[model samples]
Target chain A: MRVLSSNLRLFWQGTLLSYRALFHWLRPAQYVASKVFMPLAQMFFFVFLGTFATSASNAGFYIIGNAIQITAVSGIFGVTMSVGGERETGTLPYLFGTPANRLVTFFGRAFMHILDGMLGVVIAFAWGVILLGLDLSHTDLPALALTIAVTTVSTCGLGLLMGCLSLITVNVMFVNSFVYFLLLIFSGANVPIAELPNWMQAISYALPLTRGIAAARLLVGGAPLADVAPLLWTELGVGLIYGLIGYVLFSWFEFIAKRRGILEVF
Target chain B: MNVRVLFKYWRTILIVAEMTIRQQLMDGFIIFTVLFQPIIIALLALWMLKGKGPDYAIFVVVGSGLTGLWSSLLFISGNSINAERWSGTLEPLVAIPTPFEVIIFGKNLANVIQSLLSMVLGYIVAAFFFGYDLTIVQPWYFAVSLALSVFAFISFGLIIAPVFVMNPGVRAWQNAMEFPVYLLCGFLFPIALLPGWTTPISYLLPPYWAAVSLHGATTVGTAPNEIFFAWGMMVLFSLIDLLVASRLFKLMLYKARADATLGME
Candidate 1:
């Protein structure tokens, strides 16, 4: 019991410290500006020009698509880049030197990333509602929140895995670019998956973003939470599997790098 | 004095450009990702339109061609700037007597040549695989539109380069711009497929005009004088972006230099 209590305390402290570090790394002004401006700019551009391709009834659909996009951009890109940065800056070594459990440390940092992703989503949702004049009543709020949470956690897990595998800054950039293209192509971010080819649909179904977006659409189209239960369970299961795999792989890599004395190559 | 300096350094710039091109090509992964990926995407679109008329194939060809050009330009310029900045070489290069404009101009020139080559390769592959009949009735108008769009895109790239220099975390912003442009710019489908409000915003982007002009040139069988209008708009946008980017680059230089000096202490 005492050991468990101590571990919990350490985890809490690590999470707080991670947030502080991230806050320092990302200046407040820049964070606020990115959170506010990016979504607003996208809303304006999409709402203004998207009408030429589709219609107002589908504006709601576009808003939901943009939401998934915002999550991917903020969670996958933002969280993974910070992890890679920490590895590059030699902080991970000092972090590992501490007596904290590695899993706790990993989850703690991931918790902070989830928080950041949630904040970005809230800001984007607000921008979509207020600036773009999107109708939120069309969406089930609880399911939307649930979808965001699951998607963010799953994406952060993949990001953690990629960050562990990356050797250089260019590697991170390449991975991010590749993932962006893959997600956009497969996730039905711009068009319905039903409209896509069978092979593409298969790929989309395999991605967390696709499930999350599907659940989100159900919520946005005014379906009850019970209707989205399958989606929620699928996302939760996939997220846990990916998160566990990532945690194990990262721990193994850290062990190897430390044993080889090449941990500080960055 | 100017002529002498130009003559002295011009050969060095050409050599540097050549080396940059060689290094980029040697990276087979990058070549495949940047060049072949677009062709694959074009083929996918072609597959979707397997039973459509030649007009639809022509539309896909033009859209894919423009998309290929935009993506090539964006990835090369953004990634090159990012690589230089992250490698800590940009500061040293900027600290030298060479004007920053010249260095940036040289980089843009290299990127343009690389992107043009990639576009040509992509077009040929797309044509052979997809059975696209690319007719060039108003070659001059098409050329003019493409040149202007490339210029505007380079300027847009410069405007965003300072962000990579300042905060590497914001590189996603550079990419986030591409998604909307690709979907909304009437690239794979007509702009009319989008909602009513999206058309004007698409018009604002240079790629939309390039695609529109190219589509008209290839399909309408007669060159509309509107191609000149698109070129004029692109030039104006290019000039504005250039001015803004120049100012931002200067600011980035001063700030980065100060940060470096402080760290040295």
Candidate 2:
């Protein structure tokens, strides 16, 4: 209980520090413009394109898909960029030298981003319904919420992987953009997985968001939680795998950085 | 300007373009965008149009490729000055004897030259991977339309580059401008699918003119008059953008020197 309490304290502290750093770096207005308004416009663009390509009934597919994909924006971009920012600001070495559990510290900073990403999805979905009149009356709200939770954790695991990779990689942003576009295409965010080639479809199944997006579509179509359990389980398994791999990679890189004493180099 | 000064200016622009190309090549962000973005966008579009026949596949390939060009111009060329500012070169560049606009013009040219790879990559993907027909309606006309499209987009980049240099907030504005322009300019789809009210706005943007001209030349049975109309509109928009950009450049220079805000952002 004491250990759990301490971890919880670290988590809240990391979340507050992340928010404070964010506000300090960007003005409130700029943050809102980039984080809020920009995502809304992105959603509007895809929703309209989906409508043109398919029909109004398919808008929910895009609405939910894009909403969830927003997690990538926050999860992947946010996590990697946070590490990049630390490196740029010359605090990375100090961060590594600290005695605290690295995973707890990193996860604490990254934790709120999952919520931020979910907020993006919620905002996009709400905007879709209000502006585009997306029909959500048939959706299973509980199932939808579960899908969101799984999607956030799964994508955030990938984000953690990206953050860990940033320590050793020279061009983490490039990797982030590559993963971002890959997800956009392969995660059934824009195109249906069925539309992809067999190999591509197989690749999608291995990706973090593909199963979660499938579950999301089912929930949006009013499917029961029991119906989406398999997908949810698959997504959870993928998330766990990514999380474990990320933690291992992060620890290995941290050890290497300390041995080489080049952690300060950008 | 005198003939000697004109020669000197042209030489400076070439030197800047040469250096900018080398610098951009070493930039991971620029290279990633240039190489990966177009292919992914084109592939995604192709997947969406899987059963829409080979002709539509050709349209999507070309459209997605050109959309990549536009995005590169906006994010890379448009933010070139901002990048220079962050690197502490903007102040020295401004202090140079040559007009800064000349340097930016060189940068824009280099960017467009680099972006042409997207077109080639798109064609290669379509022809080899997707197995779409590689024929054009009027090869010479298409070639001319393509050249004009690059020129028109270069002019568009010039206009935004100044706005980006002058206002830090314009970075957010540029980010905000991206997808909307992609939709409005009919980069991947026909603008007719959009509401009627947006038509005039699309007419005013250079990308729309480029798309129409390129698409007109690519698609068979497009009336001869329609092709020429696209070419004419492209030139008109290019001229207008150049004029507007010149004014903005002057204003930006004046403010930058006066306030010493060239490196502010």
| Highest TM-score scorer | 2
Number of the top DockQ candidate = 2
List model 2 lDDT by residue over B1-265, tens digit each: 1224335799887888899899889777788777678888888777666656677666776687687788789889899788788888888888888977778878988888788788788888888998888777688888998899887888789888888777767665665676778788887777787779999999888888788878877787778788788889988877787778878988987887888777786
**After superposition, candidate 2 runs with Cα above 4 Å error:** A1-6, A19-25, A55-57, B1-8
Q: What TM-score does model 1 achieve against the real structure? A: 0.75
lDDT of 1 by residue, B209-231 (tens): 77777776666554476776777
Fraction of true contacts kept, per model? 0.04, 0.49
**lDDT (Cα, tens digit) per residue for candidate 2, span A1-266:** 98778877877886677656754555565666656776776776677667666666777778878887877877787766765566766777777877766778777756777788788778877887887777789888877877887888888888788877777667877888888889989899889888778999998988888988888888777788999999999998897788778889878877887898777655
Scoring only the A-chain of each prediction against the true A-chain gives TM-scores of 0.87, 0.92
lDDT of candidate 1? 0.65
CAPRI-style grade of the A/B interface in model 1: incorrect
